[model samples]
Target: MFKIKHVLLLSFTIIALTIAGCKSQFEKLRLSNDTGKKMSEALKLYNKKNYAKALILFEDLSQKYRGRSEAEELNYYYAMTLFKLRDYTTARFQFKSFADTYPTSRYAEECRYMGAYCFYLESPKPSLDQENTVKAIDALQLFINFYPKSERAAEASKYIGLLRAKLEDKAFSNAKMYYELGGYDISNYKAAVVALKNAQIDFPDIKYAEEMDLLIVKSQFAYAKNSIEERQEDRYSEAIGYADEFAESHPESKLLAESKELRKDSEKGIANAKSVLAARKADYEKYKAQLDKEGKKDTTTIKTPNK
Candidate 1:
């Protein structure tokens, strides 16, 4: 048993030493002054999916191969290596630079598309900041502009649609927030109306168009309901107007009945507001009549001297 264990231990140690020796040899090759060997080994590592090592070696080789005929392929591979390592920012810039440097290269078209795709990958979630999303849209559109007849144009257009949808989501959410805010600070409902209107104009093809119109009508109604009595009539009239437009535009909308209810509510609100104003006006006129009667009584007594 002891001999068996000893043999096993010896075998394991030898295997470890062999691996260590191979690693040392690779290290020597990687750090050697010979750029050619590094180039060969880097491609090997890249093919093996050892992207971290491949990226380091490729970055080193890029400077050494500058202005040489090998520079074009070197830069292209270097950018791809960065992409493999998930360094999207640098990868995108490098890809763009490669396209500019070698526009006639067969890889140029693919590199441009890859640059835009990297930006698309960097686009943030819809709920987060969308600067990257907008950048991605612009990049993809530029790709299409350059390669209108290319097979990748269709794919680029698809990505643009996705990014624009994200923008639409963001705008819709912001407008909904304003509507829900509801008199929190100085006519948020009015702001909601404006925002929804702008969003509709900006994204006419949005899926939320019907929903946005319904919300606009709802917001106008709420704004009128919360206004002072004198302004409520005019504001509710505006709400009614919005509801009518919505009904006309979205005849088949699921919210059509609910939107018609908004019109009904606004009409009731206008009538109630008018009633209150009329009551207040009648009270004011009665008080004025009392004042005039008292004034005339005093004037007549003074002129007759109580005789």
Candidate 2:
């Protein structure tokens, strides 16, 4: 009786295991089928340009198929949906996440490219903060490296060029504004000089490099003109320093001849002021001495004049 009971228990256990295995398989098939249907619907909406609805369907599919092949596809399409909707900030996040999650996937390179485009999309005018420009440059360069053969490689390269020039223009515009605002004061002049130097560093080949050189020279000349008469010598010295730097940096610049003429005038003015100041001091001292001698002689003359 004990042996018979044991066999019956064994038979019941086998039956239960078989049923459980079939149920698990059925669940897997059902999820797969549902995922395919959802993906199909999302694609239809995407094709119709109904991004609002498409995004919802894609996002739902991504969540439902987490840890499955369908999840990766869903994530990629969802990012594209966000891009189409002009929701670049969220799209950028999604693309970055997908790239990280599927670095070896076939879509990795395209994901990176779109990520860079999203950064480009977020960038404001060249005059605004350049945080997005920097990010775009980094992403584009990475795309260039990873997908040299990609169809979008040329476009990525173009964006990099554009972004770099934009940053350069922003710096140049700021420095030019300082110069325009009568920035001949010591602090203002220094600020303009620093900004122009940074522009050169950031964009050596920009067409306005020569223009910036001229502005630097003009700033120095103006600064020299505004100094106190007594301090004009020091001011001229500093002005000549910037003038020389500009001349050396841009020997063939269009403003070269004019800059030289200004330097010469500054030097001559310094000399003439010093000479006049010295002569005035000498004349004053002589007059003071003569007055003192005359007073002493008159005091000794006593009443002679009245007699």
Candidate 3:
């Protein structure tokens, strides 16, 4: 038992001594007037991923090396340290600043890409606020435009597509919401039709294209059926047009059954409307013939003053 206690005590002593040695060495280098030594140590710490210590040293060196040749490298490391620490907002700002301040530096292009990439990292999911997503897209596009021959252009383009899809998702949701809205007083069905149409135009290759077009057909059917008799014929015809479009576009869609049903209903509605219009026309003609047989002169005349 005494031997084990001695060993444990010795281990604890060694650990305590190691900690004190590190702390003392760090303090010694921190207070020294030797910027060269500090720069070397900071770089070593940064490369080792000791961002906390690297950050402290880099901050100190940033002010010391201002307007000097070493400032470029120092600022680059400082911005990267911020990025590695997950301080993306500040890191992005610093990266952009680095690029602007050192436009001709070898690291400028990389820092510009990093600035945009930071925004991409900050982007939320499709369902959340997309301000960051927009910024990411804009920044990335600017990067691509600024450096068309860059090796990073392909990756930036891929990210731009991803962010655009997210925007498309938001648009789809808004349009779908209009479809789901209740009450005819709001004309939400019209809004739904307009929204879906715009989505189709904006994203022709949208993954939801089939579903959205099917929805448009359904909305047209509802809008037609609920309309007054005067509008039912024309509206039902429009619904038929939409149904035909969906059928031609997606012949194998599972929603084909629903589209077929909408077609049947709209055709029936059109026939009924036509029949009613024919009956009204016949009744008007019959009344006019009776008036003619009665020799009715229903014209009115205004006589001018005799001259």
Candidate 4:
């Protein structure tokens, strides 16, 4: 048993020393000035899926070979190594740089597509800031434009559609936010109507078109309901118009009934507002007549003193 244990320990020590020696040898190769050997070893490591070590060797080889014919292949491997390690930010820059530096290289098309795809991968959710999403759309579109005949153009177009959908969702959310805040300030309701209309114009085929139209009707009604009495009649008339349009456009919508109800209420609001305005006008006229009569009597009474 003792001999068996001793033999096992010896084997383990031999394996550990072998691994350490290999690591030392790799380190020596990495620090050496031999570009040709480094490139050969980097490609070997990359093929073995050892991206971390491959990246070190490729990075070193890149500088030594720059402005030379071999630099193109070395830089391509370096960027691909970064991508394999999931360093998307740096990988994207490197890929773009590689494409720009070697537009006629066989790898240029793939590098350009990959750089744009990295932007797509970095895009955040709909609720977050969408700078990356917009960039992805633009990058992907530019790729498609440059490579209209390329097989990857279809995939690029698909990504652009997805990014545009995200933008549409953001626009819808922003408009809805204004509608929700309308209870705090009546002006926000009008703002909501305007914003929702703009969204419809901008995204004519938007999936939320019906919902946004419903919100517009609701916002217009709320705006008229909260306006001052003098403006209520005109505002309510506008609300009624919006509701009519909503009903006409979204005849099959589940919210069609709600829009019709808003229209009915707006008509009633206009009538009531007109009644109040008429009463106010009569009161003002009566007060003016009384003031005139009192002034005439004072003038007649002062005539004798003047004579």
The clash count for each model shown is 0, 0, 0, 0
In candidate 1, what are the lDDT values of residues 153-232, reduced to their tens digit? 99999999999999999999999999888958538999999999999899989989999999999998998888878888
**lDDT, residue 92, candidate 2:** 92
Model 4 off-target regions past 4 Å?
A: 1-12, 282-307
Which is the better candidate, 2 or 4, if ranked by lDDT? 4
TM-score of each: 0.91, 0.75, 0.79, 0.87
For residues 231-251, what per-residue lDDT tens digits would candidate 3 score against the true structure? 788889998999999999999
C-alpha displacement of 228 in model 2, angstroms? 1.7
1 or 2, greater by lDDT: 1
What's model 3's lDDT at 46? Answer: 94
lDDT of 2 by residue, 1-307 (tens): 9999999999999999999996675445435657677678678879999898778777667767899877877888899999999999999999989999999988888898899999987877877889999999999998899889999999999999988888888888898877776644555765676777788877879778778877776766666566546666777777677678778988887788887887897898699769977997798678778878887432333222110
For model 4 the TM-score comes to 0.87
Worst 10 residues of 4 by lDDT: 298-307
Give a tens-digit lDDT track for model 4, residues 63-141: 7897899998988988899999999999999999999999999999999999999999999988889999999999899
Query: Superposing all C-alpha atoms, what RMSD in Å does each candidate have to the true structure?
Result: 7.2, 16.8, 8.1, 7.1
Return the TM-score for candidate 2, rounded to 2 decimals.
0.75
- State, as a TM-score between 0 and 1, how close model 3 is to the true structure: 0.79
Computed on alpha carbons, the lDDT of every model, listed in order, comes to 0.90, 0.80, 0.90, 0.90
